[model samples]
Target chain A: MKIGIIGAGAVGSILARELNKLPENEFQLTVMARTARNGFTVLEDGIKIFHDIPVHDILSVKDTFDVLFIATKTPALLTLKETIKNMTHGNSEIIYALNGVGYDDMFVQGIPSVVYVSGQQHDEYIEHFVNQKIILPDQSFTYLDRLIQIIENDESIHFDLVKDKHFEQVRYEKLLINVGINSVTALSKNTAKIFEDDSMVRLTRTLLKESIDIVNKNSQTVYISPDFIDYAMEMYMSYPREMGTSMYYDVMANRTTEYQYIQGFVYNLKTDDHPPTPVLDTVVTLLSGYEKL
Target chain B: MKIGIIGAGAVGSILARELNKLPENEFQLTVMARTARNGFTVLEDGIKIFHDIPVHDILSVKDTFDVLFIATKTPALLTLKETIKNMTHGNSEIIYALNGVGYDDMFVQGIPSVVYVSGQQHDEYIEHFVNQKIILPDQSFTYLDRLIQIIENDESIHFDLVKDKHFEQVRYEKLLINVGINSVTALSKNTAKIFEDDSMVRLTRTLLKESIDIVNKNSQTVYISPDFIDYAMEMYMSYPREMGTSMYYDVMANRTTEYQYIQGFVYNLKTDDHPPTPVLDTVVTLLSGYEKL
Candidate 1:
């Protein structure tokens, strides 16, 4: 099966390197960027790991693919929807590995996956800082099985997505996690080091509670536990102190942020039945102000 | 009458120049900083206004004043308690022209005043931006009367203090304004330009409403109108777009901020009768985190 990845950013670069572990003949991998480049380098624990994946410019693509991964920042995802649709046939399986939610609806055959892979990209290098876990909702896919068969045969790549029957619960859990870590880190413009401050941790828990209240009100999504707030706080403490979240890096670099789809998405879901989310609303306002600025 | 100014920052420098408007021989004025400086230059509307006021080293100060003005930033006020007390005699009238509230109780003769002068000092110059109006509580002072009489003679310095019939209302109004503008500007690292964005104005109103809720619950203070939020928003729009608040400049320069006495002063005033201030509470957390970072 021919595989194609659309971006070569931090997450997409890691995706490319992990996919290279698959057997060469069965998987024809093609990584795409705006301009064709040699490869990407990722730094883990201050050590360099280079991936020499073949990259193609999106403007010059000639052949269609059997499976495609839409790997881009949340702001860049919607613009690539028609291009992604044009590159795949009816049998192609497209997986969206993004930081925020609410972009999958733009695609007809879009398979929204809860991407757990986290890292930051800088000039000439990307920093790999977190787990390489991708989860897909348990559903049928036509050509993806062939790609899964080859991955299952070798199984060297630990970043491949697998089916999960309880994806609804997991999806909300990931959203809640981002709502906590991403909002604070981005707004503070600090790394996970901010978690060391006890008041910072308390603030994160407050934001999580506000998000949890909104998710519980939505019947369409699974309800998350209040205990998850404590668990997520623990997870934040587990990260390397100097590491930055994707949103944090975005703000530091003065790029577009994914706040709208993460915090703003949950905020827009509030009905009259749901309690008001004053903290979340204020954060969203500040984030919007930053974007315009 | 002997007069002393404790700081040489934006407010203090402006105070020296404004006081220079009075005849030189009547009021023996001295400006203090860590080291002696020649003078300061203020940039108003891209024009330079030089104040050739002589500056003295605070360590080498020798004279006790009949009246002294503490014009330092809020963070620098507490540490100068001993130095300030030493510089004043028993009959001295010490005035604190600070940005935030709750600093007067440190001294028995500490007379708190609401100063409306606003500016940001850069490398070698200060930018004056707002009105130089000072409002003092309606209370009698011994040496303060002669100094007021001196000001009433020349009547040239526009920044001198005058007694107010309802000083509590003005004090709380100034606190609420700081709670709104200073918090947003320091956190966003932007200037009054942020008010141009409608969402930012709305966010400011939300914070003001939160602060007003707490002040109304305190029986010791007068209740502020909810309509003051709108008035404050209108006032923010009138500032120069490039102008920044003192707290904003402090954060930009990585100096200690005045949050402890501004938002923090209001947060600590909360009683059981007050409603929860989730937005203000979250903002305080972020500002505290920035202080630690």
Candidate 2:
């Protein structure tokens, strides 16, 4: 199998490393990044891990892949649309391991994956904090079965295939979790410990509730319950006290965040019938101010 | 008349200098500060202005004053209660030019002043941005009349003797303004320019409206209109782009903020009948987290 991954970000780098672990005889993996970087490095358990996977600039990649993973951030997807179209063949299976929802329509035969991982990139390597199982749609796609078999057999990473009918719920659940945890931590400049305070917990819960409302109202197949608020809070507390979100790192580093796809997506979904999401609205405004600054 | 001021903070230092401008023979002014520093300096319109007013450590000050002004922050009031008791004579008039409300009972015979001033302290000198007229009780109290006369005669400062019956409204209005502007600026780490964004303006207005609701519910005599939201937004916009509130400065300097007296005062006034103030609650919680950091 010939596999290609676009964008050598933290997500792409981690995925490339994990997939490269498969037997080289069966899989030939290459990363098509914006820059022609040599290789990618990731820090696992405070130890440095290096991968020498071949990386080529997207414009230089003339060959098509059997399976392609679009691991770029949501905001960068638009700029990569033409490149994505040029690199995919009729047999290619494009998997979107990106944040946000309702973007599946952008791809002709794209499969959205709910990525359950956290990593931060330094100058030389990415730092991996949490590595969990990714949830993908369970369908009759030939490449998906092969991809699942490859991932399921790997000892390092985990994968879950959910029914296609129930994939929206899983994706939105991940979105709400990101919306609640990332926004607060980014604004407060704290980590999971921020949720330990009762008031912080209440505010996070209120924001999650507002997001769940927007999701439920916008999607007919996905319905989020208020109880997910508690679940989200518990999940945040389960992370390390100093575990910072990608949004938090971006704000600290003075870089643009995926807020347009996360909070911005929810803010844009406002309708007449849905209740006013004052908390989400306020956070989105603050995040916007932060981005401008 | 012998006058003494407590707390040599930004507010205290400014009040001491303004009072020292009075006629030397008619009034004797001294500042009872936590430290026996030589003097205080303030920056006015980029010009370095120096004031050599007498400063004495509060514990060492033995003289009683005919008029006393408590210019300490709300948090420092508790630590100075005993010192305040010892420094006031039987005929002393205590004027609290402090922030927040319901603290008048802390002094047996106290007068509250709604101060409309903005200043930030550096290592050597404080920067005076705005020095507007202060609103004091319009009663016939002897020291108040003397204080007002001295202030009214001064060319640099201004004072307004408001009716004692309507003083709470003015005081609460100033408190609400501080609650809205200080908390948001502190949390966002931006200056008044943060309010320039429409979303920021909306969030600030929402928080202010919630504060006004709480104030109206707690006070039968004072009713804040929803239009005050627009008024407050305009006021914040009128400030210089880089103007940072005292709370913002405190947060930046990693010092404890007066949030307890500002946002905490409003949050504590919550009752079953009052509307939920989620924004204020969140800001307060974030401020609390900031304090811990």
Candidate 3:
């Protein structure tokens, strides 16, 4: 199978190395490169795996792949839209491992249907943060089944094909988690450990509830269930004591955040729904003030 | 002339020494102390002037002076209420060389009238950042006039009793300035220098405008004129580049702040006035989070 990944970030790097392990998958992996990295390497349990996968520039992208995955940050998705089209000529199954919701509607040009999954990006590779996977509607799970079979052929990486709503439910659920954890972490410049405090627990839950309400209003059916909230709370409790959300990383690194898309977007939507979201409003304003810093 | 100064902080200390220097007036000075201090010390131009003013506890405060000044922080004001009857015995005139507005409504229970001024608290002395002296509308300014005459008698301490509104205007003006400068400094954990950036400048101005609107609606008909805004911008610009506000000092020292009187009071008043103060609201909420830290 010919496969292409657009981004050379942690997620792209992880899949490049792990997916290459399948003997059934005769993969000619192509990586689109913007910056010239000396090499691509991923270390798992102290074992360093190197990918000699052909990394090419957009101008040099000439081959059409059977499957393509975009593993970059969400903001870069729109920017890389034109460049991504050059790498494929026909229909290809495109999997999206991104942080937030609503990526399928963004890329409108000639591209195959997309699948969304929750994944964590590290320096060298992406670590899957969740067990379940959700593939949205209008996309056949057969493509995912093929992708999963190729990966499950190897014992190293796990695979699953979850119901589409399961993914949508989890996406909104993760949005609530991100809204609370990401915002408080960024504004307070504290880690997730601080959220363990009773006061922060209350504040986080309030913000989570607000985001859940926002997600419900936006969705055709209210996908924010009690189980989703419970699952989110459990995920938070399972975090490493010092683990911080992506927004927290942004603050520590002094970079502009996805706040305009995440919290700010939700706040703007609040007026249309007339949902009382003071907690989200307050955090949006606070995080917005810190964006420039 | 005799002056009794309460709350021997920087403002009280400077006013005590400067007022005591009225030789032709032969001023008898007594400083009220919570715990007995070594007396008022003014360090000006490498010369340290110390006055052996009699210090008395609030319960035992008696033998009223010709003029009295209250220079305590707002948090300390409520405690002084309990001792007011003893503190204001006999024919004594009171002056409040404090930070905020509306002290007469607070301090006039035991004493019929008092004076007020607005300025910065220097270390163990008051530095007149802005050149103006305001006296409130009280019967005691006649006696206050004699004390002012003694202060003006000396060419060193330059001051004069301007109209009462001139004083009242600046008191709220200083409160607004504190509302702008102090709270941001404390919350961001940065010096006043941060306001020089365009984003910080814009945020600070938004906060100032919100606060000014709230103040005008709830308390007085105050306009934060363009000139006043420029004046505040200039003051922030002229701050010793690395200097943080006094509230920053409190936060760094891990002491409670006058936020209750500043932003806390403003938020509460906004509820009463039916005006929403989201900027101040967010600031207070985040500051509360910091306090929890």
Highest-lDDT candidate: 1
Evaluate model 3: give its TM-score.
Answer: 0.58
Cα DockQ of the candidate 3 complex: 0.12
Q: Can you give the TM-score per candidate against the true fold?
A: 0.89, 0.80, 0.58
Q: Is model 1 an incorrect, acceptable, medium or high docking prediction? A: medium
What C-alpha lDDT values do all the predictions have? 0.82, 0.79, 0.61
The prediction achieving the highest TM-score against the true structure is 1
The model with the greatest DockQ is: 1
lDDT of 1: 0.82
Question: Looking at candidate 1, what is the lDDT of residue B12?
Answer: 86
List, residue by residue over A1-293, the lDDT tens digit for candidate 3.
77777776656665555565556446566777676454576555455656676566645677876777776666777887776766654456666665655556654322222233334456665444433333334345434456666564657754333335355554555556777778777766666566466656666776777787776677774567655656666677777766667777666665667777677766666646475666676566546544433
What docking tier does model 3 reach? incorrect
Question: Which pairs clash in model 2?
Answer: none
Interface quality of candidate 2 as DockQ: 0.41
Tens digit of per-residue lDDT, candidate 2, span B1-293: 88898877777777777677778898888898778887888888789977777678888989888888888777788888888888887778888878777678887768778876678889888777777445777578877677676676677654343345677777888888998889778777668888778788878887898888888888777888888888888888998888889887876676778888888888888898776787887777777765554
Clashing pairs in 1: none
DockQ of all candidates, in order?
0.49, 0.41, 0.12
Query: Cα deviation of B64 in candidate 1 (Å)?
Result: 3.6
